[model samples]
Target: MKYLVMVQGTQLDYEAMRGKASPHSPAWSEQDVQAMYAHMEAINNDLSETGELVDAQGLAEPAKIRTVTLGDDGKAVITDGPYSETKELMAGYWVLECESLERVTEIADRVTRCPQPEGAPNHPVAIRPIQDGAGDLC
Candidate 1:
């Protein structure tokens, strides 16, 4: 089965990673950012070697987001964001083809342990199984 493993962060978190310190998060040093990239690379490499990785990507900053809602006239109403700077938004995700939920859970655990600045928030990692088709009833 395929699973989507996601990690979330606030706008403050993104700023911190870019070395901008705010009351909510500390600035990350160049080394701190490098370490995080290396850790994630290692995990991706391992998954690739094991033939379990489908796709992976990191999202752009929250400031560039566009929210679309249905207007009363049934047209798309667009809103620009840096919406609720403290609200958690998806930071990155990995699509993995794994033998079981336990395997993906183990990978998510490793993601949670990725190195970060000393005062960084411990964000939770989420995993959801992908439904291939209607045959996946349940």
Candidate 2:
């Protein structure tokens, strides 16, 4: 079966507090983000070689985000990106063809183990089984 794995956004105040001199852990920096990308690329390359990677890509900045939504009036609302009203935003996602949920869980485990910037928050990969034939109607 094919499954989708994506990062879940964290809370806004939790995301906003990170800084260089954070009384605690610092927020993600450009270098931190770059390193994260490198880690993702490495994982993707390995997955591709193992024939586990169905497809995956890094997400763009939230400010450049866009999406379609429905309003109370039932009107189609073409609005800005990401629905998360918090600081933590989806970084990217992956669609993997796996033998079982356990297999995908292992993949998520490895990804969550990735070294992240300080105060990067928890790594929560949401997994969902993709329904087939639904696209046929599309």
Candidate 3:
């Protein structure tokens, strides 16, 4: 089965790039932001090399969220982004192909331990198994 591990946190997990001097900016030579990106990329590469990664990427800021709600007419009403009131919003996700929940949990632990942007706490990840109707996903 395929599982999607949701990586989310209260503070911005990708905040490492914010306020930090950009490599492109001429005035800033404070730190190496590219190294951070490299770390993130390394995780992706590791998953790809192991053939467990199905798909993965960081999500857009939740503020840009758009949710669909049902109107009185039974039609869907498109509302502004981020319906959830909690500060803990989904920030990114990694989809992995695994045979057991334990395996998925192990991978989740690895991701949770990954170094995130400065000032960001370790994000909580939610794991849910995906259902492909065919059932022969081996």
Candidate 4:
């Protein structure tokens, strides 16, 4: 089955990495960030070697996002965003072709342990199976 693993974190987490300051801990040293990336890269390499990783990528900061909605006049209304209403944001995702949800969960568990700044809370990775049949759409 193909599954998507959505990596979630708060806006503050992104800002902390960018500004070298974390709300949950002291400023992140350059080495700390590098180490984190190294850990993540190792995971990616493992997954790729196993032929389970389909794709993976991180997103730009939330502030760079734009929200578009249809206005009363039926025109598109665009707004800048950090999506202040929400505390959590999707930071990245991985698409994997795996044997089962159980296997995917195991992978997610590993991701939850990836290095981050001290005091940072463990974030959840939302995992869902991709629909493969027309019946699934209904």
Candidate 5:
């Protein structure tokens, strides 16, 4: 089965990125940020070597995102982000072709273990199966 593993970071998580600092440290440090990326790369590498990874990518900050909806007159309405009501912002995603949900969960668990600022909770990793050929994905 093909699965999508989505990473969601909370508002606090995004705020912590303003300056580099280990969540456990008293001061910001670039090393902490580098370590996080390194950890992510390692996970991606492992998946690639195992031939389970289809695609993976991180998203730009939410401030740069835009939301579109239908207006009262049927015209498109646009809003800029920092969508406050959402508990978490989607940070990144990974697509994988795996044999079972168990395998997908294992991948998600590994993602949750990546390093981040102190007191920042693990970003929720949502794993879902991709439906086969029911309609055009595009």
Candidate 6:
């Protein structure tokens, strides 16, 4: 089965990563960022060596987001930037072909353990099964 594992972050988190501290998050040092990158790279490399990785990617800053919504007139309404009300957005994702949900859960657990600055918020890592065909519906 294939599973999608997602990591989330906020605009404030992104700012902190870029060395701008906000009231909500502390600025990340250069070493902090490199540690995180190394951690994620190790995981990806391991998955690739095991032939379990399908795809993986990290997203750009949320400030560059453009949202498209359905208007009352049935037309597309375009909006810029992240949702004003929602702080958390998907920061990255990995698609893994695993033997079972348990295996994917283990991977997600490791993701949650990624290195970060002290006092940094521990965001939840989401895991969902991917449907390959109509038979997978439940």
Best by TM-score: 6
The whole-model lDDT of each prediction reads 0.93, 0.73, 0.69, 0.84, 0.81, 0.93
**Which 10-residue window of candidate 2 scores lowest in summed lDDT?**
12-21
Q: What TM-score goes with each of the models?
A: 0.94, 0.71, 0.71, 0.91, 0.85, 0.96
Q: Write the per-residue lDDT of candidate 4 for residues 5-39, one digit (tens) a residue.
A: 99987767776776556556556667777987997
Kindly indicate the candidate among 1 and 4 with the higher TM-score: 1
lDDT of 6 by residue, 1-138 (tens): 999999999888888988988878789999999999999999999999999999999998899899999999999999999889978999999999999999999999999999999888889999999999998885
Compared with the true structure, the alpha-carbon lDDT of candidate 6 equals: 0.93
Taking every candidate in turn, the Cα RMSD to the unseen true structure, in Å, is 1.6, 4.5, 6.1, 1.6, 3.6, 1.0
The digit string of per-residue lDDT tens for model 5 on 1-138 reads 899999986545555666633443333247767888999999999999999999999988777779998999999988988666876788999999999999999999999898765665655799988989857375
Off by over 4 Å in 4: 22-25
Candidate 3 lDDT at 94 equals 86
The numbered model that scores best in lDDT is 6
lDDT tens digits, residues 8-127, model 2?
554332343333334334576667657766888888998899898999976655666778888899999997756765456666799999899999999888888776765545757888
Tens digits of per-residue lDDT, candidate 3, 30-53, equal 243465456668878988998989
RMSD versus native structure for model 2: 4.5
Q: Cα miss at 81, model 6 (Å)? A: 1.0
How many pairs of residues collide in each model? 0, 2, 1, 0, 3, 0
lDDT of 1 by residue, 17-106 (tens): 999998888899999999999999999999999999999999998888888989999999888885554488889999999999999999
Candidate 5 differs from the real structure by a C-alpha RMSD in angstroms, to one decimal, of 3.6
Question: How far out, in Å, is residue 101 in model 1?
Answer: 0.7
